[model samples]
Target: MGYKLSRRQFGQLVLAGTVVSGFSYLTNKALAQTPNLNIVGIGSTSIPTDPTAIPEVKTTESYSTHQSSVTTDIPPVGLELVLRSFTTGSTQVIADNGTPLLEPNEILSGFTSLRDGTLVVAITPLITSRRKATPNRLTFLGASSAKTLIVSGLNENQQLGSLLGTNDGRLIGLVGSKNGVPPITLVDINLKTGAISPLSQITIPKDKRVSNLAECPDGKFYTSLLGFHGETSLVQLGSNQEKPIVLAQLKVDGQEWNNGLQNLVCSGTGQLLAFGAMRYQTPNAVYSIDKKSGNMTRLENFDVTQIALVPG
Candidate 1:
């Protein structure tokens, strides 16, 4: 027969266990909220301090402007939805399969497709008020009765970086400086009410400015840090960390290490890829970056001007 306990004894035992378990649960919750800011460099590729030191890699793919068929279904495996901006101040959403989604009149700096198929766009102004920065606007397009304004008042000093869609109908974006300044602010945008709230902010180390920022699948943010001395490294930002954590130095041979990097996209494959266009008229290459080690793997060369990835 199983051992039986007295009524009072059983009650006391249950209470003790509950108290212990509750403490353990609260401890884990606190630890989870804290971010580890340790730098983890994996590859032996020495991070170059000189901007002139570019990684040497042969071009494996060519740029093309062909569009594939559009579908209402979720993008297929190995393919993602993309937003391509033109020099004429026009923006169009295209799938990795080459399907055209939408074109708008305003210049879109960042965009994200929500879980409910709603499209949230960041309208980046071409002109900035040098005297004082003004708020950028967020517009809602498609999946609604008509185009609507969602939120405004993004960071004015910093041009808006890539926007990442969240599972809860919210969006995350970076307000990064164009002149290599510090204090890149991470903000949250609501799709329903268009409210904007800053979750956290981190400044880069001296001589380093963020080129592009993307949301990793694990809820952390990452960016490509361009050094004033001509070096570039990938770094991660945690909500609890006050400073950015360096992941790995990027290898950009023959590519402009400065503002040439654009359209940083976090993919479902747990990597970030972007168009590394050194300058106009130069063949651009797509490179994939590992979030953990900051290592970059060149994918293929393509000609699209600016490409945004579909949110995973």
Candidate 2:
């Protein structure tokens, strides 16, 4: 069954995941510390220099007027690209020589970098109507002006999930199951034609849905599964494997990660980085996952929805 949220909850939360690479544009200080290794994400807070630092609570402002104010659904905000350094704990926006890559009335659903460092992002137009259907467009961003691509071959109800850039330089994405079924499928995204080709279906439990996708150096793919009742799991699968192997039930400080995790990316050093999206009673943060043990170490208090790694 599909999970539904209220309008207020929809405004407060965003589905997170993105494929990221290329850090040649960061500051010299960040480069000197981590070299080619950097992290980019969509969030409200910057990466903390101290891992133990708690995120400060943010209060909402209130406005009062004499006339009657109409209430409406809060539209999703366009998330900005924030560059982060894991080693140095520094953060900045990804810009073209100090010029920001900001777009109006667009929500970033997913993104990945081409081999030449071109960023391909999946954008959904900002809309307030819950009944209106909005298709996602693929956009290329770099030194030049932004170019939009029309993505074809998806049904009216299908939506793209997290994006992944293969080691062989191929762009891959996850497509939710059609007919509201289980086992999401992997698809190859043709950058030139903006067409999607189905590869294989990921075998998971009936009540579970994939949140993000990542590929490691060993050629194996990893993903996080969100259960019906706040259950989360990390699984590894490959072409030769008959079925996905459960690595661990995701946990932090001996407590279950019920809020779930997304934006899974393999770091330059083969480490897995993920963004834990915020939910009621759960804090949004970044964490490093141990593939062998399924243990998680919180890296910072940033409220990131999606994240990617820049290779040196």
Alpha-carbon TM-score of each model against the true structure: 0.53, 0.68
Q: Residue 280 lDDT in model 1?
A: 35
Regions of candidate 1 where Cα sits further than 4 Å from its true position? 1-106, 128-135, 143-146, 154-159, 176-180, 201-208, 253-260, 280-283, 290-295
Most accurate candidate by lDDT: 2
In candidate 1, which residue pairs clash? 51-230, 54-252, 54-253, 55-252, 55-253, 63-303, 68-98
lDDT per residue for candidate 1 within 1-312, as digits (tens), equals 211222332222221001100001011221233222111000001122355544322221111223222122211112222222221233232222222122211234665555443445565433322322234566543322334454555443345656766645567776655333565566776656666777654443444455556665676667676655546677776455567788776655544354336556565435566566543336556666555555555555444334444322
lDDT of 2 by residue, 42-70 (tens): 43322333566443333211121222222
C-alpha lDDT score of every prediction, in listed order: 0.44, 0.56
Misplaced by over 4 Å in model 2 are 1-35, 43-106, 125-134, 177-181, 201-207, 281-283
In the order shown, the candidates' Cα RMSDs to the true structure are: 19.6, 11.8
